[model samples]
Target: MHRAKLASFAFPDRPAGDAMSVIAPQAAVPRPVSRVLVVSGDAALTEQIVRGLNATAQRLDNPHGLVALAVAQVDQALARVGSDGELQVVLIDDGAADLAGSGPAADLAVQLAALRPELSLYRLLPADAGGSSGRRAFDGVAGEAIAGWFDRGEVDPVGWFRILAAEVAEKAATPFYDRLKAYVALAKDSWHTPGHAGGDAYLGSPWVADFHDFVGEELLRADLSVSVPMLDSLLHPGGVIAQAQQLAARAFGARRTYFVTNGSSTSNKVICQTLLAPGDTLLLDRNCHKSVHHAVILSGARPVYLDSSVQPHLGLFGPVPQVRLLQAIEAHPQARALILTSCTYDGLRYDLAPIVAAAHARGIKVVVDEAWYAHARFHPELRPTALECGADYVTQSTHKVLSAFSQAAMIHVNDPDFDAHLFRENFNMHASTSPQYALIASLDVARRQAVMEGWRLLDRSLRFAAELREQIDATGAFRVLTLDELLADEVRGDGIRLDPTKLTIDIGASGWNADELARVLLERHNIQIEKATHRTLTLLVTMGTTRSKVSRLMDAMQRLAREARSRAPASRPVPRRLPELPHFNRLACLPRDAFYEAGERLPLLDDSGQPNAALIDRVCCDQIVPYPPGIPVLVPGQVIDVAALTYLVRLLRTQQATDLHGLADVDGERQLRVLRREEAAPGLAPAV
Candidate 1:
């Protein structure tokens, strides 16, 4: 039996003086009960176990009470457990052998474990069964799924209760966050580098008092600095921060995990800097985030771009075909690393196991940018995560899908040859010495939350998305993009999967472009979507998504559909044709060289407002990226072609709502940065 005393601490939100002023004895607050579900067809056995648990709870004077409910069928047990967030332990009666190895009960246990990995499952055996020497113990999946087994006649209820209490306490611990809260409760005066000195600068001034008040006193007070040695230094963690990171590593299934406060973008850059050197070859996914492109430039790696299948109709880019990816690995055997994004922005996931295996065979490291897939490892349905696929390094934006503040991310290392000292140096290069203590605490708390309830939260989000997809599809004016619709013909049978939580709705039938519909939804219905293309809107169903939000979104979509149907034929808007996405295949020089070289901005259009064909073959010196899907259309050192230039011209003319990053407005005309003509050496061979 394990018993750990719970820590007693004052709430950080309460003033220090108030904590000291409370001297009177107060009534004991009701402790939350630990819910246990007993699955058994025998009423007598069920009552016996429930009575024992209740009596044990009373006898021990448990700080947390106990409640047990019995369900006859495995289906009912599963349903109850799924819906009850407080339920922790499950006891199944297997005396009848109905739930013996590989039976329905065994399957139910596996599913319940997946839905709540922290849940404790035990099998109840008959008294004589344990004494039978010929009886074989549970084996295989059933044996592994169950936490323990108990013979009813010899059951130790008090021991079981203590074990449950210890497990709960372990999962509830957030080392860094708890310490931060306790330190804040001390009400220590700060004379640190932060000039605000715990918001005193703002609170004392009338000019900024409103701003400070709006931001709240608790947040301001908790905004601490490195001067407080107890909080531990992020760069050289040896205390609570180190413990928090180790806990996160165990939760996320990483060999080692490092918390990153500068978002996954910086995480990618740090990894790149640590792994790659100038002139090293890299195999990269073309559909990756712009941050990857920036990493290439900063690391000075020679990139061999892998083509992603394009869906011209929906303006979407699918994952690289498995065949193409494998062939690229073979072709670029000299490549130092292979980096790709799993669960692309629209939620297209690649079967990375084979891909990672192939990359490893060639002595090339695999780095997966799972920036939007922080919750993938927590659920069984979302298994085969990058780490599980043998990736050397994985970067995740915890804030995107989990309960963390923005810019909070993590870098997970599983490399066989990872050099901690070198990685730490690179991490410190990108990390700020004056890091936000609140953000770090948020990361610590986020890890604890995910470990405790990630499966339940994800299960709810998946169901919500499914319900919304069906409702939206029935609206006639809109239809959710199924896997078949999202995948291009070339990559149809590539073992690709769609994340059900990400819904991409095709709104072509609604008679409104995606931008117009998004604006209407935000303005009229107070609803905001994740991203929008010309004819589709993508919505993310995250842990934060609620039933009320799902219902409100459906209601808004139905109203829009009705309005579309009522509109006159002449009033219905015509759909606009978008240009095919351009490919960045022409590498005239090294990206590092071109980016560092002298460049001049030239008008994209002539006086007549037509594209200046003269600039077609010029070498681009900067990245020209489209905003919604932040993939760069033209990267540095690429020789601009007619197709690429025409696509840019079309976007400038028709897609005024789209933001082109590298284009500048000079004399009221859009211009691009290109290397000087003299600098474009003659007969320069393509780098790729």
Candidate 2:
């Protein structure tokens, strides 16, 4: 039995009448070992060892129980081993010990034993420790070595019991596994098309207990085929899904809205496919989202690029300038539409009304990728959202700020020129054929929440952001970028006034790059901020933020500022520039043609000169978006730029590097496919 009090370990000879015994009666019972640590230098090896322990317990009808860490620090190992229900054993990975600095094996064992007198240590080395690349089959020779260790006192009774307990707990606590088992027992009808009739006589699916655990059992239970009543009807839509779309439109102050489960990237494609055709020109922002470029490819539109002023001080990208917008429109009189980002990820808000008016005067349509600024609609203090500013097509990520699940977004139609029916048709085509009812429900709930409390919540967020800025400024190590004071000045003329809710801290005074500061904060204090670049660290405040959390962050910032002030001022690096623009005729392939062709994946280095026809991947195991102001460097259906490639190469080298190269596709292992040379012949596919 586990003790209610851990004091028993320290005071084993306490009097029977003591208050400790009175409060924790269970302390009298001998404690069953609870905590454990399985260590390995190789991440893959550690995982395999843990898996083998679970598999062994399964064969013997034992519970597999143990907590594992891959190459942890000395303090972390000691802390875990020294707990009330302290760890019983440490599994040392011999291979990892050799790779890492030596002495960890013997040193860790001594430290763990000192921390917990009852704890034991287990040493695990590959069978061929000195030969054969140290890679042996776990079931073959490695398993035998492990079995021999089990026989010796080294593995011991505690190790065996801990492994057994882990398996038992895993089996008992999983709700998803239970739900899957229950579903199997339900009677089958000819109601779904997994197409196998729930694995009938010819094909029985092997029972996998972990499916529900992967994505929640309720979602699996609700994953009914289109024939099920939950989906209105994919062949001819009209039902609950359609109603959800209507609700989104109403809440966001739009005449019409389309639900896109595919994400804003695909929504962008649909907007272009429905509106533009070959020979048309689009007034494009230099700092445009990747999706907009993809739209240009699909729509066969020629883009008139409007250059944006790069903020040299911040080493950041901002909104397109008004002069450039006018210049582009004047230069390309045949332009049919305009597109831009309103509130940049760094929270910069562009003065778009004047630009919107200029485009509308020419009877041109406007589409704004307000993806990051989805919360702009609820607060009047925030810049007028695309819809409020009279943009023809406003694409927003309701899921982004409003708390809907990812891939749940809305395409609002605010202009008479936009065809609602056409937008819906493309939305359904690009989105999932098997749409989730829960996703629909989440969109509905987010919309309702935003309508009811968005303004009040945003107002609170604004105050919190302001307070944080003030505190950071008081320390003299950083200053918050505010549009109110800065926009009126000459030096900040190129910068857009920012939303009050955006807490963008300029760390120029601290003499450290934003990247270094970000790492320090997370490693030392366990606090995470948004992406940090050369000059700025951005923090986004939402309705979920509280004053206490802000205060803690403030304290941490002050401590970091103190540390940084003592260091020599960092040398400022000269600003970088974009490469010579690629020759559009030779570099880009029409999306319609690329869509019908097949290609292969190549490394980012090998991809130079070769046409890149897909969006650049950015995040860690997420859609590839370069975080602070996540505009893609390489857009889909466009050739990769040397300058953009250089930017990505530098990003990959930093501690921020998660993936090796920024080449592969976002969702899965599928490679980016561009049109082959044979498919790009004249008249085979016409271009703008």
TM-score: which candidate is best? 1
Model 1 C-alpha RMSD to native? 7.3
Identify the runs in model 2 with alpha carbons over 4 angstroms from their true place.
1-220, 223-225, 230-237, 484-496, 566-688
lDDT of 1 by residue, 181-294 (tens): 999899999888678777788866768877776776678888988999999999999999999998888778788999999899999999998999988888898888888899
Q: For candidate 1, which ten residues in a row score worst on lDDT?
A: 6-15
How much is 484 displaced in model 2, in angstroms?
7.0
Q: C-alpha displacement of 161 in model 2, angstroms? A: 66
Please report the TM-score between candidate 1 and the true structure: 0.85
The estimated TM-scores of all candidates read 0.85, 0.58
Q: Candidate 2, residues 596-672: lDDT per residue as tens digits?
A: 34544544433453323242421111123455344544443444445554556565544242343335754543233
Top candidate by lDDT: 1
Residue 353, candidate 2: Cα error in Å is 2.1
